[model samples]
Target: MLVFQLLGGDLRGALGPGWEARIADPLLREDIALAAAIDPQQRSLDARSLAARLRGLEPRRAARRQAREQALQARLQAWRRRRELRRRRLGAGLTAVLGVALLATGAMYLKTEQRRQQAETATAQREAMLAFVTGDILGQADPYDSRSSGAAGGGIRAAVDRAAARVDARLHGDPLAAAAVHGMLGNIYFAQDAHDRAITHLEKARTYALASGAGDPAGLVQVETTLCDVHRIGGHLAQAEEACASALEHARRAGPGARHLATLKLGQLRSEQGRHQESRQLLQPLLEQDTLGTDPRLRGELHWALGLSARALGDYVAAREHFGQLLQVAKAMGEDSSWLGWAYNSLGSVLVETGEYERADALLQRAHEVFARTQGEEQIETQMPDAWRAEIRLLRGQWDEASAILQRIRQAWQDRLPPEHAQQQRIAASLAWADAMAGRTEQARAALAAVPRRNDPAQARARSSAWRTLRWSRVALALDELERAGELLDLFEEELAQELPDPHPLRGETRCLRSEWARRRGDAALAVEGAAACRDSLARYYAPGDPRLQHLEATRAAFAAAP
Candidate 1:
């Protein structure tokens, strides 16, 4: 235990350095180490016995102990050198890893900054593009540089083309600019009624707007309204309705009165489709306001719409009342020629339907004169004078003259008007009737076949059934198919009765057809019944002196004489 305590205390005291000094004798360190290893539990060694062994030791054994001590000292030095080398290598490796990590972090931060700057630049460019585009629109300036620069004969088309070109130029290398330009182009195309081109541009604009993240509600509404117009013009009624609905919904979310004009358009669409109740419902509230009511022009427009809707619903009294109100509004507004012409024509039609043919003739003539003054020698379809004159000619039995006038109208309208215009259909129907009366049966058939069919639900609901039955009856009569004509005329009567008012415009005509059919079949009682109904319906719309009523009376008398 004493020897063990001595070795442990001496080793611990010499922990840092000078182990050779602590040994005192050169071979003592090895002897102590060997003794500790061999018999550690033998705490004490005999000093006299160690000396005796040393004295008796062989020369070779003493040399071997010295060699063993030197070898153990060499091993300790080699192990320390290895540990120092390992530490230096580890420090170099750590430095390299930290340097790489720092460099990678700096590079990532730089790349992120570059991306952020690029995105900001792109956003700024988009804002600029929107400003320029919106400015061009609101300015109402000539879009074309040349047109705006005072070029002669600079039409709306020239202006739009110029603006479109400029917008396209600014779009170079700019996706957001491209989107704005597409929307602008769509607007131009829509103005020209180039629906296909408009659709292409609008769709492209929508894509770009979404891509550029410029999805403003107002901007979306503008684009949607244009698309709606295109669809409406194309006779895609359902699509148009959807577009309008979307626009209205968006407009409501945006601002007050934002959709006032859109609502008017919706009302017009409903009127055209024969939804009189809905049309009235939509416009009536709009018209009740002072802003719409007191303004002569707006009032006139409201009354005109109301009259037309009433007319379509076969409410002649209400139609006449509305038309009269429009006439008074026009006079009060000092709207002299074309506007008055329309009001007069509408009034005249109502009067004619109510059997006031003499009064109707005066109003029709007045409308014709007004058109001649305003529109010159050429009569446009929408020009009330032009159509009212044609109507007058037909009512007067000038079949050949009416046909010539309508054919001329058709030629003029071939390029100028949309294919689905209601006036065009009316003109075509009149032409067909004129041809039938003129004994040109095949020509009449062809003309009748040319009447375009409307898929708009409102229009179909309004007149398709009645008109179809009437058309078939005419066709059968033209073919000398008496049995077929009788059946079709009965169908026409029934269909007309379902839709028309008691004093409808077509009541006289329907009765005359039915009377004729019954007389042909030798049904005197039915013939008399139809003739009486015809006279009653005629008296409601025309005065006693009206030429149309007189002619009808003559026809009924002749048929009665046949018995």
Candidate 2:
């Protein structure tokens, strides 16, 4: 309003009637007052010039207008810069997230592709294994083939022998399948008691499985378990221990079934190594589990190992029960007669320990016949029952017959057993016992002296150790070396106290020997007491026909009081 009036050249109207009261801006009021005081006469003219300048060329008003516009423009530019910066940052963030997503997708794609390829490869390997097993391993035999000459009947053993040669040719591209086949063949050979062949194939399987990316830890467990067992039976204690430890290490990473088998195998190896107490300790936990798993063969083998451990520890009742369980398992399997025969022999061996000689004889005879008919005499399986029969004769002092049987099987045992093997040591002791009975004292001492002590000190308290010690005592008695005989018998008595129950066959035998020792020392009352104790404790269990039983009866009758 003031500017409009000033442009109209009416300063009084622009400033209003009371100009000082109307103009509120102090700087404007002061400017107007100063203009009026400069020259009142020219105030009107100056006001007119100011009004003209306000209408056209006012420098203060133009400067104020330019400063306000520049401030507003600067504010607008700052807002635009902030918005642009936010957009650029958002674009960069989005780019990074998208790149991360793409990388994740790529990784997922690669993992899926890898699994698919592995599955396909496994399928190919399984298929190739099937073809090789069917065509190369289990095919109908060729009569014209060279295996007909020496492998006897061109049997499964012969087929395996032939297939082993062609494994690299048939499954050369798939070492995993080759490992599987070799493992299978090794187990078969192990079953057949062919340790050399079994070891050859099992070692090859181990090599291939480790190198060929064998995905199944269970396969490694199986190969290692069998290899461990083969070395155990072959009397390679150190190798057996290493293989068993490896089996257990692999088993820890595998499923429960594999772990169970490996653990059981290690327990069995302990039994073979004369760590009977250790074996029982290792195996007892597996039986404590809620379930023993679904494999009948595994259950059967568990019983077998438990029986061995129990028998080694001189728990004859438990051993008999376990062997009975093994028999039931073998019966359930029906067609596995080899296992049936083994079960029979095992039970018979325990029966012998318990003085059930008649029953033991029957079982041993049956097992020997079966093994002789099926597996042949060269097999340790056949030799096992045969050796037991020899032991029975040796117990009865049928030295000639017993010595002949021992000589027959000695070569077979030596062929497979290492020089210092436990079995070899036992057989050598038995041979010395035969020499003792024949009055060849120096020869007996020489033979017994050649036998090395068991590798494990714990075995010094074992059932096998007791049996060896008993033989040494008997040899001393036969030589009339009463002092040596008394010392050895004292050791045998201590071992029997720890290992055998009352009325055990071995205990009864030791008692009879003690009675004879007393008789030789001219102690009639003590001899009568020992003879009566042996006769009373063993009368019901021993076979009526057993020579030891007859001998004990005669000795007791000789010491009886006159009527």
Candidate 3:
């Protein structure tokens, strides 16, 4: 029987604090004492015998005893009721007090958070003011000396970290502040080639900016724009587009000039999404606008993008001219620009395409030094210069150096960028070429197989480009797969027939692959004929010392000297 008194549980802790006094009232204590003194030795008087004795002697005495017993019973019941009421009141009062205390704690926490945000906002304003002034001073200083801050190699990073700590301490609870902090952190992470970390921070900034309310429209747009860039770099096309759309909306709401940056970002997003026509349409008008009214760095960047887009669309002559203009602008502005390396790298790429390998190598090498000195060994996207340098090494037949550079690029891309990114695919393909040259056929094939074959047309094009240059040609030659090599040659010929007219850019490449295939099959006559075809194409399309022509010459010479 689970009687309340015999229950195996403590009541004091359940009642919270101050339960002892209510349990120990005088009347309550007396009730407990009387219960404790319920003795077997004490007898209950027999009322019938008392009544009988009272009838003969003292009936009034029996009545008096009965009245005393009734009074005792009433007193015991009253004490028990008061004790139960006091216990109930104590419980209710304690619960109410604790609830109030919790509410007070929550209010204090919110107030502290608000104060912290205010302090952070004040600090950020101060830092922005300082940066503006310092940047102005640096602008006026000698261009080369402006880069030599007291912090030197790691100093800029150290300062950024210090500022980040301040932001964290003050703005951790403020959504807008956190968003700004996230964007700043993402910039540093991106420079360090820590794309995963950059993505994390950019995502945080995006979420926070969306929820940061209607406070600062410009700040919100900036965060969103930065997130869009991160998504593009990380190869999250859909997410990048979504972020750009939101940023555009914010820009529209913020009135004039705000949309300039949003427009630029939208153009970038469009370009990545393969909406090249739209991208060009969006950016061309802005580029035509007076350069004096816009940010010089942004102007340079826009020009660089236009040049790249032109190259992608196969206007190499126009791309070279556009890059030249961008390069001059960056050089003239000098310290006022952050796009110096970009200009150089883009110029170098166009030069390489135009068969100016020596100039391309020199420009790309300079760009590589600038990036390495400024951003360290990270920043893989910004390391286009380094990739070009490796390409140059491959062209020069510096097998060991090319192989090492390609290995580093593959590792960095796999570690930092999404595995399916076009840049990553291209790097893997290049590394596969290096492996093929180094006589690691199994490794080369493994690398080639890992390149994804998605249904997206742009991805298909990119894969095809990498496949033709890296796998199809090299693999067929190494494996002596003449039939497959002929099939690939026919496929390329068919593609060019649709995509372009006669004298296609890849004609030399196609002929070279076929020549290698014929040579591997021990058909000297067919090898010489294919090599001659490639030589003729190369002579028409490329410079005198182009590596493809040299390789073709070597192949022809070998065949002629054969016994």
Q: Report the C-alpha lDDT of model 3 over 263-382, residue by residue, as the tens digit.
A: 888987776665556778888888777532445556666877778777755567878877887887677555223355777899898777766878898988878766665555555744
Which one is best on TM-score?
2
Per-residue lDDT tens digits of candidate 1, residues 330-369? 5653433356777888898776555555687798877777
* Alpha carbon lDDT of each predicted model: 0.62, 0.70, 0.62
Worst lDDT run of 10 residues, candidate 1, spans 8-17
Put down candidate 2 lDDT per residue, 415-476, tens digits, no spaces: 76765666777777787788888877798878755533444475454335666677777776
Candidate 3 similarity to native, TM-score: 0.60
Ten consecutive residues with minimal summed lDDT in candidate 2? 4-13
* lDDT, model 1: 0.62
Of 1 and 3, which scores higher on TM-score? 3
Candidate 3: which stretches are off by over 4 Å? 1-178, 212-214, 273-278, 291-293, 332-338, 378-383, 411-414, 451-472, 482-504, 507-540, 550-563
Greater lDDT among 1 and 2 belongs to 2
Candidate 3 lDDT (Cα, whole model)? 0.62
